[model samples]
Structures are given as C-alpha cells and as structure tokens.
Target: MEALGWFLFAYQVFVLYYFAVLNFLYTTFTFFGLNMVARYARELSELSLKDLLEREAYLPVSILVPTYNEEKTIAASVRSFLALRYPEFEVIVVADGPKDRTLEVLKEAFALVEVDWVYRRALPTKPIRAVYRSLAHPNLLVVDKENGGKADALNAGLNFARYPLFCAVDADSLLDPEALLRASRLFLEDERVLAVGGTIRPLNGARVRGGVVEELRLPRGFLEKMQIIEYARAFFLGRAGWSAMDALLIISGAFGIFRREEALRVGGYRTDTVGEDMELVVRLHRKAREAGRDYRVLYTPDPICYTEVPSDWATLRRQRNRWHRGLWEVLLAHRAMLFNPRYGRLGFVALPYFLFFEALGPVVEVLGYALL
Candidate 1:
C-alpha cells in the first residue's frame, strides 16, 4: 500500500511538470513571436512596397487553385485571385473531377474556351481532360482532370505551371490584395528562401464583397469564435516562433508559395499522405540538409489569406480529427529525423518538440487527467 501511494504521487508530479513545461514553452514562444512579428511589420513600409512594385523586380508566380467540389464559391475565389495587386502571375485552377457543375460554372463565369496549350509534364498526375483559358481574363487557365485528391490536383497544376514560382491556394480561400506582393518579396530579397508561408484567418465572420473581405468581425458561432483563437495561437505564436529559430515545419497548404524548381526537384506534393503540405515542407528541409545546401523555409505575418472555417459542431470535429491525424502522419513519416544530428536543428529541436509536445500531447493529457 505504501509503494502504491508513492507510484501515484510520482505520476501526479510528472503530469504537473508536463503541463508546467508546456505552458512555459508557450509563453516563451509568445514573446519570441510577438517580437519577430513587430520587427517584420516595421521592415515592410508602404513606401518600400510601392518602390518594389515600381521597380518591377519581383519574381512572377503561378497561383494554383485545386478544386474538388467547389461549385458555389469557385467564381468568387477565382475573381479574387485575378484581382490581386501583383504585376505578373497566372491563375491555374485544377478541377479535380468534381461531381457538380464546377466546370460549367467556371466556363460560364469566366467565358472559358477550351485551348490546346501544350506544356511539359514535369510531374506525373491523373490525365488531364482538357485545358481552358478565360476570354475575360487572359491570365486565367483551368485544367479539367480525372478525380484525384487535393495533392494530386496540385501536382497537375505543377505539371502545367509556367512561372518560376507557384503559390498554392485552396479553391475555397481568398487572398488579400497585397498578399502576393508581400509573399513573393521574400524570395526576391533573399536568395536562400525556398518557400514562404503566410497567415490564414478564418473568414467565418468577415464581410466579403467582390471576392474580397471588406470587414473583419467576430464570428457569431461558438465553433468559429474558438477557431479564430486556435488559428491565432498556431500561426501567430507557434509558427512565428519556429520561423524565428529557422525551423518552421508546417506551411498551410491553403496559402504557401514555393520556388517552382525546388518543388519539382523534391518531387512535388506527395499524394499518399493527408498531411501533404507538412510532408512536402519536411522533405524540402531533409533534402536541403542532406545536400549541405543553405536554404530557408519562412513564415511571415503580413500576407493574409481568408478561409471558410467549419461552422457546425460535426464539421468542426471532423476537421480537427483530420488535422490531428495529419500531424501524426507527418511525424511518423519523418520519424528518422527525430533526434539525428544529420538534420541539425530540424532533427534535434523542431521534430522532438512536435513529437513530445504536439504529437504525444493529447495522449499525455488524457493520462494526466485520469491520474488526477
């Protein structure tokens, strides 16, 4: 009975220490993140942005929109991409064989005419049915292809993308007017940047007009309100902290830009994992490290993309479950890099943090609750 008492007491102490350390790290990250965000904000002035645009020294980007069954909002989403303030970019909308009238909607809305635009297939994807270009907007191109997942659709876009850089945007999301200019500026300023991740805010309560968010307001639903906080912590605190340390792992697939050549070199997006975005970023880090190349995967706060969050309980639960699964999927895939010195800080610091604090966090939390 005495030995049992000691075991119980030790378990309780372990749980306490676990939470204390987690909270402490969160606090530290908050400080680092706030400082980094402030520094970045000061660095990017309106005059500098105008000067950069005036000089025309920006790298052109191909914006890829992968759609599955987005018939309702496809038109608005594409319009927002076309309305971006960037100088040179093409919008590639891959219709990943949606069951609805997604193609018809695009054809009617944008006056899409089927074109036989020949392009090199750098990455293998499901066969493309036809390619269409918009009469209203010359820069818009749509690829109608077989039913493939989101990653497969992105790969198809990569196959036909012509620009030196590509920005992946979900079909349901909208980018701010200056989003492209700000994100692409990173690559232009730094030669070593392989990718740049931008901030994503929930569009649940925003007033959107002309495919742009005109007003930002608190969401009415409890789920959406909670999501706003979750996103703030994850991106503003977690991502910014990791980025300041040069160890950012997951870049949201909804809005991330990559150097096209580097993406192709790393074999594009992997279709096998639900966590394709995180996996692709991880692979990029692993490859760069192995090659002894100096590269930076960055996360910045200025550029923003607004995405529709789950409004209902069932949908919210499903989305969170999928995200959690994705986290574990990525951690397992790169298990070899957990503490190996070969990958340096990524292995030693970032991976371990994700493994111990993020991945195993829930399991430990549940155990802690039971013990308490």
Candidate 2:
C-alpha cells in the first residue's frame, strides 16, 4: 500500500511537470508567432505587391482541386479560381470517382468537353478516366478518375498539372482574389522557398457573390465560432512562429503552393497516409536537409483560403481523429530527423517539439484530468 501511494505521488508530480512544460512551450510559440505576424504585416505594408501583379512578375500556377463528392461546391470553387487576380493560372479539378453527380454537374455547369492532352506521369496514381476542358472557362480543366483517395487524387492532378508551380486546394474552399498572387510572390522573392502555406478562414455566414467572399461575418453555429477563434490563433501565431524559425512542418492541405519539380523529385504525395500534406512538407524538409540545399518551406498570413468548418460534434471528432493520426504517421515515418544535428533546426527543435508536445499531448491531458 505504501509503495502504491509513492508510485501514485510520483505520477502526479510527473503530470504536473508535463502540464507546465507543455503550456510553457505553447506560450513561447505564441509569443514568437505574434512577433512574426507583426513582421509580416510591416513587410506587406512596405512592399509594392501591386508592382508584381501589374508587371506580371509572379510565377504561373496550376490550381489542383481533388474532389470526391463535391457536386454542390465544385462549380463555384472553380469559378472562384478562375476569377483570381493572378496574371497566369489554370484550375485543375480532379473528380475522384464520386458516386454522386460531381462530374456531371461540372460538365453541365462549365460546358466541359473531352480534350486529349499529353502529360508526364512523374508520379504513379489511379488511372485517369478522361480529361475535360471547359468551353465557358478556358483556364479550367477537369479530370475524371478512379476512387483512390485524397492523396491519390492529388497525384493524378499533379501528373496533369502544366505549370512549374501548383497550388493544392480543397474542393469546398474558396481563395481570396489575390491569393495566388500573394503566395506566388513568396516563391519569386526567395529562390530557396520550396512551398508556401496560406491562411484558411471559415466560410460560414460570409456574404459570397459570384464565388467570391464579399463580406466576412461570424457563423451562427457555436462550433464554427469556436473554430474561427482557433484558426486565428493557429495561423496568425503558431504558423508564423514556425515560419520565423524556418521550422514550419505542416502546411494545411486546404491551401498550399509548391514547386512542381521539387514535389515530383520527392515522388509526389504518399497515398498511404491521410495526412498527405504534412507528410509531403516533412519529406521536402528532409530531402532538402539531406541534400545540403539552402531551402525554405514558408507559411504566410496574407494569402487566405476560406473553407467550411465542421459545425457538429461527430464531424469535428472525425476531423480531429484524422489530424492526430496524420501527425503520428508523419512523426514516426521521419523519426530519424527527431534530434539529429545534421537536419539543423528541423531535427533539433521542430521535430522534437511536435513529437513530445503535439503528438503526445492528448495522453498527457487525459492523465492530468484523471488524476484531478
């Protein structure tokens, strides 16, 4: 009985220590993030962003939309992409074998016609059924393909992507008119930038006109309001902090731009994992570090993508499950980079921080709650 009491006391002490450490690290990150956000704000204010747009200095991008059963939002999302303020861009929508009428709706809405275009299969993916070019929008292309999954669909779109730069976005998302211009400018400014992640805002209760979000408003759902606050904290602070240290690991799959050549070189998206976005970003970091290349994967707060957040408990639970699973998968898969000095800040700091605090955080939280 005495030994058990001693053991329980030790466990309690450990939990307290863990709780304090975890919160301290997060608070540190929050401070760093706020500083970075302020720096970005100043940079944007001083920089002549319009000069890049007017002079057409931004790189061309192929926007890849991997859709499963998004019949309702596919057309509007494509319209949003088409209306982007960038000088040169193309929208590639991949219908990943939806049982619903996603393909038919896209065809009817956009006047899509079959087109034979040659593409290099740099990465293997599910077979493409047909490629369609929209008569109504010249910059729009659609791919009908087998049901592989999000990663597989993105691979198919990658194969069909024509430009050197490509942006991956969720089908149920909408980008700001200058989103491409803002994200692509990072690539132009820095030769070493391999990927750029944009901020994502919830799209509920916003006044959208012609596929563009004209006015922002708070959603009626309590869950969505909670998420809006969460997003503001994560993107504005956490992501900016990571970017400041050049240790950003995860770029939200909802909106991110990558160099096609670097992504292809790394064998494209790994289809086995649901956290394909983070997996790809981590892989890029690993490859660049191993190759002794001076490279950066960045997160910018200006380029915004609006996505619908889960408004109910069940949907939110599923989303959180997938996220945690993905985090574990990426952490385990690249365990070699955990603390090796060779990978610099990534292996020494970022990888360890994620593994200890983020990945194992839930376990610690549960232990603390139970003990309390």
How well does candidate 2 score on lDDT at residue 79? 87
After superposition, which runs of candidate 1 have C-alpha atoms over 4 Å from their true positions? Answer: 1-4
* Quality of model 2 by C-alpha lDDT: 0.91
* Model 2 CA lDDT for position 94: 91
Question: Which tens-of-lDDT digit does each residue in 288-317 have in candidate 1?
Answer: 998999999999998999999999989888
Whole-model Cα lDDT of every candidate shown, in order: 0.93, 0.91
Instruction: Give the range of the ten consecutive residues with the poorest summed lDDT in model 1.
Output: 363-372
lDDT of 2 by residue, 78-149 (tens): 889899988888999999999999999999999999989899888898888899999988999999999999
